[model samples]
Every structure is written in structure tokens, then in C-alpha cells.
Target: MSLVSTLIIADDHPLFRSALRTVVAQLLPGVQIVEADSPDALNLAVQEHPRADLILLDLRMPGVQGFSALITLRGQYPAIPVVVVSAVEEPAVMRRALDFGACGFIPKSAGLDTIGEALRSVLEGGVWLPPGVTENAAAEEQEERELAQRISSLTPQQFRVLMMLADGRLNKQIGGDLNVSEATIKAHVTAILRKLGLYRRTQAAVLAQRLLRAESASLAELGSAAEGGAEEEAE
Candidate 1:
């Protein structure tokens, strides 16, 4: 089995970016790397690419564009952690990047071993800071998990409606598919949004997929374990 995680590398310096890719490949073979030349390409990749598990960033990528890119990308896809790998090692600059949602910061001069360790750590639900950073990525993850739990309390009807939303089914279509009235589906959707702390149905839909997929994975693991146990007992 392979870990299906994605990585986007956005930097203006081609040589450095290529080196970074090699480093990542050597470290995290499970990660699929995508390269973006300009900030625009990076931004587009962030939106168009589905399932970006991590991002390796170069902060000094011409015009100081990477910082703003990091901010916008984090704002849109907070689940994807960005690791800043830049030559700038100023304490203030490092702290600012972490403040703006960078999960880790590694100086460009850092050795291959350190970079690999940094990316690996962040992918495994941990954050890396060279020395000092005010914000903690683990705390944010805990908060997100707490919010997910609160949202998971949706009523059965709301949960079903959210599942439909995850399937990209519209309200009326979901109602028809589930043999419920459209108005009732609408009510359920509203309840789901309220519980998920989302103002948009699309946001609720994304959250629905995350939760459902996690549940599916757990069930799969249990089934596999049971089969394995049965096989051993028969020996």
C-alpha cells in the first residue's frame, strides 16, 4: 500500500526548487510533487489540484510574492500545511510566517536531513520551527478536530443531507433521491450548516467528505484486521 499524499512546490528559482523536489522524493516517497513556476501558477494549482496534502514553499521567490501566496492559500485550504523553506532566518520573519499559518519554517541553508525531517514531521500531524514561533499548528489541528466533533452531532437527517452534499447532489435532487420533500431537505441542510459552523453549503459539503472518508477508512481497517485474524486462526 502507498500513502497517497500530494505536495506542491512553488518557487521562482528553478535550481533550488528542483533540488527541493529531489530532497522531498528521497524523504517522502509517498508524496506526489507538483511544481509551479510563478505565484500565479502556484495559486491556480492550489485551487485546481484536488487533495494537496502538503506544500513546500520558498519565501524569497521574487517580489516577496511567497508570503502573500502562503496567506491566501492557507485562508482557502487551511487543511493543507505549508512549510517555509527560505534563506531568510531572521527571528521576526520566521515568527511572521508562522503567524500567517505556516506549519513549519526551515532555513534554505538547512541540510537535507533537516528538511526531510521537517516535512515528514508536519505530514505526520506535527509542526516544525527552527527556534521560536508564537503560533502552534498542533493547537490549530486540535481546534479543527473539536469543531469537527461538534459538527458530527448533526441529526440523522442532517447527516444524510450532508452526505448528499458531499456527493455533489443539489437539494432538490437529494430530496428526490432520498424520497424526501425538497423543503425537508432544505431544512436538513440548514441544520447541517449550523452544526458545522459554516455559512455556505459548499463548506459543509467539504467537511462532510472529510468526516465520511475518515469513517470509511476506519471501517476498512477494521475489516482488514478481522480478515487477517481469521486467516491466522485457520493456520
Candidate 2:
């Protein structure tokens, strides 16, 4: 008997999601597709379907800060392959996605045939990048890679605490948000700092800021593309 695959399509735009769904259905008949309009919804879908074979994620979806969602998913769901599908097609962005553990990077503008091929490659345990893109390890990229490794080591709870800290949330506020006590939040903070090899919480916040800033321009482009897509759908 043939195995059936489940793919999670996590993009904010309904038009794009439908288009991807159609492509997946046509390319991989009998595949199950779960659609998520936001990062939170993606998480819920993954939880509900833990055996999902792959996730196609959008970097700028609601509740995601740059590549944080990708990082979180990679850390939390290491068994499931994640292929980033985003409007940001810069080589640098693609490199970052691979460094953060994405099995493939498919630009939103890619042809359906290319998308299908990329998805198939990832499903076959191979990494896929756009043609002509070579992996280069510059000094800055090496630094980012080290940081990503450290971040990936965090437990899911610790990761959540660290993100809250990066957002400048007080320990009390974080505790309230997670429904835990301030003391527990403090311990999680200490653990986060230790894991990231940072002495101060401020350093963690700075690192998060740097990562988000690196993708800011691409995120702006993604927003514009989403808006344009919406307008085209309406016309």
C-alpha cells in the first residue's frame, strides 16, 4: 500500500493558500493539505496532526517574527520537514532559511512545476534551493549559524520565555501570559541565557532584534506582495 502524506500549508493569504493546495493536490494525488492562516493556527494544526509529513511556511504570517516561527517549528517538530514558501526570494534569506533547518526554500513567485519539484525533493530527503544559489559561509553567516544552533537547543518552554523577553516583557507579565509564577519565569530566563551563552537578558533581546532586523526588508516586500495578491484576487 502507498503511504499518504499530509502537508501543512501555512500562509496568510487565502488566494495563495488555495493556489498551493491545488498545486499539491495535482502534483501529489491523495495528499492531505491542512491550511493555516497564522502562526498560531499552524501550531494548532501541527498539534492536531502530529504525523504531518511536511510544512510549507510563510515567514511573515501573523504571530511570526521573521524566522522565529521557522526556528520554533524546527526545534519542536524535528521529524517533520519544513519548506519555507515566502515572497522573500533573496539568496541571503534562502541561506538563512536553510541554516535554520528548513529542508527547502520555495519563493512565492516560483512556477507550480518548480514548487512541485522542490516539494518532491524535500520529501525524498534532499535539500532544495533555487537554481544558481550556492551556499557560502561568510563570517557573519557563521556567527548567525552558531546563534541558530544555540537557539535550537532551547526547550519549547524556554524558547517561548526567551521570545517574551526579547519583546521586552517583564517577568511578571510573562508569567501571567504563560499562567506560571514569576519565579518560574525567572528560572526559565536563566536557562535561556545559559543556553544561548549570554550573560545578560539584554543580550538575548539584542540577538532577537538583530535577527528580526535582518529580515525586515524582506518582510516589507512580503507584505507588499500579499497586498498585491489580494488586489489581484479582488479584481
Candidate 3:
């Protein structure tokens, strides 16, 4: 039998998923393309799509598992390669996805050729990153250096609070958004700033943004919650 690129595409957007279907149809031809409208659907489909060569996952889907389903699935199916296909193009997320076992990261902005090329590279057992990764090597090193210097002592909640600060949400707003009291947000921010040895919130915000972005792609791979949340709030 001819090799078929059996794929399971999981995303919350009907339009995006449909577009993906079209792309697969046009490019892979005889390949088998399965669809899952949400993270839960993807979880169910994973069992069905056994021997599936590829799983194109959307980052920031929803729920806690949203951060880690890929790693879990990979552990279960070591032979299958999972490609993080997301609109989140932040460099932080890109590196995290790779760190969490994603074979490739295909930003939504990528063209058909780019997507196809990545798919081919993954199938060939190579890490499929854009040329810019090497092109941006110097900046990449600088970022890692800065991160190592800055985030060496933050607690988990302090880290999360710092990221909300980066998102430009105030203590009250962050508290409300995260379901914590403003006092707690304040405390966390104080802790984060102290740990990072930063004098201003702006510095902390910038650093947090970098850290969040770095965690972006892999954030999706971290669990199944994000995808589940995507389903619950599907538009």
C-alpha cells in the first residue's frame, strides 16, 4: 500500500480547521485527514487515528491539559510526531514547543508550502524550524542569558503574576481575571520584583512577556486543559 499521511487536525475554530482540511486535501491528496473540533475531540480521535503519522495541534485551546496533551500523547505513542500548529508566533512559545517534544511549529501565518515543507521535514525525522531560528541565533542567545539571569528565583504564582503584569493588566484586574484578591496579586508582584531584582514593573513586564512568549508554543503542549477550554468556549 502507498504510504498515507494520516493526520488528525484538532482546533477550536471551524474556519481554521476547514482551511486546514483544504490545505491537506490539496497537498497530501491521498492522505487520510481526520478532524476534531476540540481538545476533547482530539483526545477521542487520537485513539481512533492510531498509526496516524501526524497530529496538527493548536496551542492555547483551553483547560489545564492545553499545556501538556502533546507530551502525554507522545509518551503514549512514541512513534507519532506531533506538530504544534498555532497562531501564537511568539519566539518563547516556539522554543517551548520544541522543548516539550513537538517535532515542528507551524505558525498560522505560514503558507501552504511552508506548512508542507515542515510536514515533510518532520516525517524525515528532522526538527522542522524556520531558517530564521539560525538567523536569529545571536538574539536567541541574548534572550536565554537574560532569562537565566532574571527568573532564577521566582515562585510559580509570582511568575504567573509577572506575566499578567506584562499583559498590562493591573493588580485589581489581574486579581479579578485570575480569581484572586487584589492583595494577592500585589503580594505576588512584590515577590516577583524582589526575586528578579527589578525596580520597575515595566522591567518585570518586559521580562515576563519574554518568558511567556518563550513558553507559548510549549505552553500548548504542556497539558490538555487549554484544548478543553477551547471546546467549552468555542465560537
lDDT of each: 0.65, 0.77, 0.65
Better of 2 and 3 by TM-score: 2
TM-scores, in order shown?
0.53, 0.84, 0.56
* lDDT score for residue 107 of model 2: 89
Instruction: Please identify which of the two predictions, 1 or 3, would achieve the higher lDDT against the true structure.
Output: 3
Q: Give the TM-score of candidate 1.
A: 0.53
Of the candidates numbered 1 and 2, which has the greater TM-score value?
2
Instruction: Compare the candidates by TM-score and give the number of the best one.
Output: 2
Q: Tell me the tens digit of each residue's lDDT in model 3 across 102-198.
A: 7888899888788878877777777777657531224535444344434534554565566567678888888898899888777777666555555
All-Cα superposition RMSD per candidate:
15.0, 10.9, 11.2
Tens-digit per-residue lDDT, 1-235, candidate 1: 2254678998888888888899888877757789987777887888877578878887766644324455556656777878888887765456556655678888887888888777777877777877554443344244443453444355555655666686788878998988988887777776655555556666565555654431122111111121122212110
Greater-lDDT candidate between 2 and 3: 2
Overall local distance difference test of candidate 1: 0.65
**Tens digit per residue, CA lDDT, model 2, 86-116:** 9888888887788778889998999889998
In model 1, which regions exceed 4 Å deviation?
1-4, 63-66, 131-235
